[model samples]
Target: MRETLAKWRPAIDEAIADLIPREIDVDYLESFFGEATYEYDPDGLQRALSDPIWELLDRGGKRWRAVLFLVFIDAFGEDPAAYLPYACIPEILHNGTIIVDDVEDEAAMRRGEPALHHLYGEDVALNAGNAMYFLPLKILTRDPANLPADRRLAAYEMLMDELNRTHLGQGMDICWHNERDVRVTPEQYLEMCACKTGCLGRIVARLAAIITDQPAEVEEAVARYAELTAVAFQIGDDILDVENSLGRAGEFGKEFGNDIREGKKTLLVIHAIEKSDPERARRLQEILQADTNTDEEVLEALSIIEDTGGLACARERALDLAAEARAEIDGLDFDPGTVDKLHEFTEFVIDRDA
Candidate 1:
């Protein structure tokens, strides 16, 4: 999986660069959004938009969502290279979500550095983040693929539906963490994952299907697989947060025990609260509810989660979802090599350390 990702990463990055370049200028603005009524301030545009945007993009990301988009195209029997530009849609949008999410989460770090808001101010970061949400739409309007009008419309509509669901999921997450009394069920957490993390993958699948002119059934099958893998990946991410905090593994980009600090009711927390003795569970809840926690409090929360089988259960859940995801593609008539890649992709989602 790493080898495959390495081989494709450069190409994926190139495709994204084409959509959003290292620099923004008057000509670029005119080309994308049309000429200004008055005059365009290229210098101001570069300072405010391009500089900060590229600052984050330069930090490494796996670009896996874009790769998934291309993989779907290949699986559907199209030349992925021919439709590479369209693949940028999900990658761009995913980054946008994280940038905005960092601001909303009051996150202190991203990709091993200060969050965008901290460096660029909330106003600039928010605008730049929101700009990414709309930037991908230019791909459709520009008609880079010269897609038929109906296909373009289908892509637009699919993006709208999926993006809306993402916010709904975010809303659920915000609400769950805000109230001390609200206990998020495993089922509800899964639903949130499906809506938030899974929707981006769904966009990859459904867009590939739409552009390839595949039937609805084919779209549905691939979309289900995509959603499952995405949710499994998210669950794995949540588990990693706990593991890293407990010093069971090397640190990743995120701050240790950040979820516990934020009082996020991750599946680990949910399972731990349910299985623990009342006192232990109450203590765990108290740690989660606290406005701030010291290293000792975070460690205590980690120990409770581990003792109550939260880590084990969450790991099992992630693995189970990955298997289900792989199963979805087992019967499909995709390219054999691509099917193998998709299987590897599912495993990578759960087994990845970062």
Candidate 2:
């Protein structure tokens, strides 16, 4: 699996670069943005927009989403290379969200570098991110020979549906964090994860099915597998955030305790609050609600969450979810080799350290 990923990662990166381009001429930018300045700077808005977009893309992601799409293609005994453009769509969409999410989360760093908003300001980052959301449409509809109009339309609609669900999930997350009276349960958290994270995974699998002209039942099964993997992936991420803070700072290319800093309603935090005594619960709420918490305060919150068995509970849930995902993969009628690869991928999703 690692070898396959290594071989394909560069190809995926090149495809994205070709699709997006590293440099956009100033004339194109001016026309695109409707700028009519007397002193037209060749390297003005065009560089401003294209630079950050490329920078973020080049900063090195695992490209797991693209790999998942290709793996599905391979499982079906199809030429994965033929669907490279479509496979790139999910990664592009995911990175676009990362840019916007960092701005919304006020994240200071991403992939071991300053976030797009931090480097290029929120306005530019926001515009670039939003623009990226539509770029995939062009790819999907570019060549009728490559992707039939019907299938293209289907993929486009699926992409839109997934993005809509993602925004709705983001709304829920924002509202929960800001509203002091809102009480978030584990079920609510899972739903949010399904929307925000799982939806992308579903899109990838479903798109593969659509492009390959697979039966509806197979698409449904693959979607279920992807959704379970996504939820488990998110849980693992939350757990890593806390565990990383203890002694693994800089290991994951992200700041430790970032979720706590953002006041995110992680499963660990939710479980901890549910099980905490009155005094500890109050303190936890105070920490999460504060405008800014010190490192010590964040550490204390982690300790409290640990004492309440929140971390352990979240880990157990993640393992269960991963197991379920594996089961779904097994149930699929793909080649046995494909099933084995998928099972391996499921474990990777759940057990990835970074």
- The best candidate by lDDT is 1
Model 2, residue 261: C-alpha shift (Å): 3.0
Candidate 1: lDDT of 322?
90
Q: Write model 1 residue lDDT over 1-354, tens digit each, in one string.
A: 567677788888787777777787777888877889999998877777777777888898988887888888887878888888888888889889999999998888888889999999999999989999998878989887789999999989899999999999999998887889537889999999999889999998899999999998888888999999989988998888887777743442336798888888999999999999999999999999999887778888999999988888998999999999888898688778888889998887655775
TM-score of 2: 0.89
Give every collision pair in model 1.
none
Model 2 poorest ten-residue lDDT run = 247-256
TM-score, predicted candidate 1 vs. hidden true structure: 0.94
Residue-level lDDT of model 2, residues 1-354, one tens digit each, is 787788899889877866666776655445444586665565764565668888987788889899989999988778998878888888998998999989987778899888888888899999989888887667766652386678878877887888899998888887897876429889999999999899989989998998888888888889989999999989998998888887753343337678777787799988988899978988887888888888778888888898999878998999999899888878877888788778887786546775
lDDT of 1 at 5: 70
Predicted model with the maximum TM-score = 1
What's every prediction's RMSD, in angstroms? 2.3, 3.8
Regions of candidate 1 where Cα sits further than 4 Å from its true position: 248-256
Q: After best superposition, candidate 2 residue 263: deviation in angstroms?
A: 2.1
lDDT of each: 0.86, 0.82
